[model samples]
Target chain A: MFAHPFLQNAFLAGTFVALAAGLVGWFLVLRAQVFTADVLSHVAFTGALAALAAGLDARIGLFAVTLLVALAMGALGRRARPGDVVIGGVFAWVLGLGVFFLTLYTTVRSGTGNGSAGVTVLFGSIFGLTASRAVGTAVVALVICALLLLLARPLLFASLDENVAAARGVPVRLLGFAFLLLVGGTAAESTQVVGALLILGLLAAPAGAAHRLTTRPLRGLALSAGIAVASVWIGLTASFLVPVLPPSFAILAVASLTYLGAAVGTRLRGTRPTVVER
Target chain B: MTGTFSWNLLADLREMWSLPFMLNAFRAGTIVAVPAALVGWFMVLRRQSFAGHTLAMVGFPGAAAAVWLGIGATVGYLAFGVLAALLFALLPAGRGGGDESSAVGTVQALALASGMLFVALYKGFLNGTSALLFGSFLGITSRQVVLLGVVAAVALTVLALVGRPLLFASVDGDVARAHGVPVRSLGGVFLVLLGVTAAEVGQITGALLVFALLVLPPATVQVLTTRPARGLAASVLLAVVTVWVALFAAYYSPYPLGFWLTTIAFGGFVLAYAGRAVVDRIGRLAVAP
Candidate 1:
């Protein structure tokens, strides 16, 4: 599998996407913003569909829409983290827009021979990545990971206790807005590897497993990234071995199973999962 | 796609409804809307939107499995939806906590992955997959409509029987439990009901657009009112109207029914939210003297 050029591109792109997703997802879970991530994933799908309907590059739609909506959500919610009500309202609207675009694309573009474009956007087309696209994805993923690391400490402080961090002049709201942008970027990038529908698995499962296993912030972060990368590598290999299995399914299966294992292991060890100090 | 709208509204509606499929679509849409709105009101009140989303996603795999086994997609939708709901109830009630949301995400991922696997394994053309996710109003057989009516009736009756106690438990679980209400069992029952409602709506709005009918109408109503009876009634009204208008619009235009349904529901939510904000500001100004 490694000998194939497409497989090589898949590994290169998958590794970076997993790293960024894991890092950003740590903050997402810590802040209890998994729902925000969910909203962004759907937004990615809608944006891509809208772009396709308008006859533009899907990548342009994927990134631009997710970024805009992420900032808009920050502005809508208090402290840049939207409440469930706001998220639900926005979520429904985005999916509605997605349906509109799907209809438009199907009606006008059906005979153009790219009938599966919508499906590819929904489920991801990681193996179809050209070398250049893979490289582009890697560079974007690295930037997201670097920006996240640079802001990790302050972000953690803000996430753990928003009011205290605000009082201490940590620019809590600004950090929150910035963090949402990173999440948007990560969601868009992960859409390439796992598709819009299952990006949450890459984002949440590894970080959640790491949370269950450890309390130290830095260790958990590293553990999350490691587990995510491992899931990608294992999932890719499994898909390669069993051609009937999709890469997204394999990756998510591994990732979620890891979380389940951690939950069961912590229970068996007789240690309750540690709640972050508020 | 069809003739331009004329000044005569009733004539236009009659022309649109002259088709057999449109009539069947209307019947199924009305059947799905009421219970979906009712159950969704409680889901929003209880802050289980994530869980609701997960149950909807579960329907995709269910449909895929049904297709794989050469069975009706409805059976797969209802069975998978209820099974996932039961599984959720078995977990400790973490109620909007980080753990519960994470678990919900995990389940959504696994279900979607399985859906992909089933799609790959199936040998058929799978052309209807788009319709499964985005919904279609073109082929609503009478048998399907009758099946939907029966499910909706059963679900609505169960909801009515448990409605009062369930509201109490949702409002204050601890106090309700102390008062001898079966809070835990009620939660389980509510989840099952929600699952059934989601399955029914999933057929009309597709697996993804279920949120349009389920969440948007109820959320909009709650934003405008706190009275339980009024809110519930208004939610149903909003949902039914949205579905009817969407179906009518979809028939005349080239856009899909799911799009029209969601867009209209979302419009109602936005209107309600803005209206509430304006009223609050005016009240505050009035009191400032």
Candidate 2:
């Protein structure tokens, strides 16, 4: 499988995507912002379609739109965490915009012959990546992972106790704004690997599994990233072996099953799962 | 497909209904809207939007598996929807917490992956994938409309029966439980109802966009009112109006019906939110000095 250029590209890009998603997802679950990730996934789709409709590169739209909405959501939410109401409102509107752009792209730009573009945005087209595009995706994912590492301590402080962090002058709100932007970037990137519909799986499942498996913050973070990368590798291999399986399906199925395993393990250990206090 | 809007609104509406497809679309949209808004109101109140979203997402796999099995999509929708709801009900209720959200996310992922698997396994040309995800108005058969009506009717009747106790439980679970309200069972029942509503609405707005009818209208009305009766009434009204206007607009325009439905519903929410903000500002100014 590694002999094939496409398989090589898939692994290269999928590895980095999984790393960034795992790190960012640990913080996302810690901060109770999984809903925000969900909202951004839809935003990535709408942004990509909007960009296509306006005759621009879909990546430009994907990144620009998700980032802007993340900032906007940060501004609208209290303590930089948007409530359900805000998330739900934005979610519906973004999906609506996606439909509008789909209509425009189908009717005016590419015609109905190219309906696959929309499907690609919804389900991802990772195997279709060129060598250059895969490298570009890796570079982007590395930058996200590096930035998240730099912000990890302060972000953790802020996420664990916003009031105490604010009292200690940790710039809680700024850190929150910055963290949301990172999440937005990761969400946009994950859309390429898993598609808009299932990006949350890559963002939440491994992190959640790690949380269930361990309470040590640093160990959990490492475990999360490890599980994520393993899922990607295993999923890719499974899909390569079974051509009938989609890559996204394989990846998310592995990720989710890992989480279930952790949950069941914790239950069998007969220990009450430690609940992180907000 | 290039239909122009005319000044005569009545004539245009009559012309719209003159087509059988448009008529069926209207019927289906209306049937989906009422139960969606009703269940969505309680869902928002209970802070279960994540669960509602998960149930809606499950419809994709339901539809895909149905197509794979050569069965009706509605059966798949309702079956998967209720099954997922039951699964959710089995989880320890941790409202708006990280544990609950993670669990919900995991379920959503599993369901979506299963959907992709079903789609991959199906050898036939599944051309209606777009319609199943984004929804289309062109294929609203009379049979589908009638099925939606029956589901809506059953859901609404259950909602009516459990309305009061459900509200009490949702508002204050501990107290309701102390008072012997069967809080847990009521929660389970409501979740099933929400699943059914999500499935019904999924047919009209698509599985991905079910929130257009389920969340937007209820969220908007809750922003506008605190009274339960008034909020429920306003939610139903907003949803029905949004669906009617969207259907009418979509008939004349080239865009899909789901787009118009979501856009109009979102517009109502924005208006409500802004209106509330403006009222609070004015009230503060009146009190100051």
Model 1 chain B weakest lDDT span, ten residues long: B92-101
Residue A44 in model 2: lDDT:
96
lDDT of 1 by residue, B187-276 (tens): 999999988988898887889988878899999999999899999999999999999888778877877787788888888899999999
TM-score for each predicted model, relative to the true structure: 0.98, 0.98
Write down the RMSD of all candidates, one decimal each.
Answer: 1.4, 1.4
Global local distance difference test of model 2: 0.89
DockQ (Cα-based) per candidate? 0.79, 0.74
| Deviation from native of the Cα of residue A61 in model 1, angstroms | 1.0
Error of 2 at B69 (Å): 1.1
lDDT of 1 by residue, A80-176 (tens): 9888878988998899898788778878888877777777888887898999999999999999999999999999899888899899999998998
Interface RMSD of each: 1.0, 1.1
Poorest 10 consecutive residues of model 1 chain A by lDDT? A269-278
Angstrom error at residue B202, model 1: 0.5
lDDT of 2 by residue, A57-110 (tens): 999999999999999999999978888888988898899889889889988886
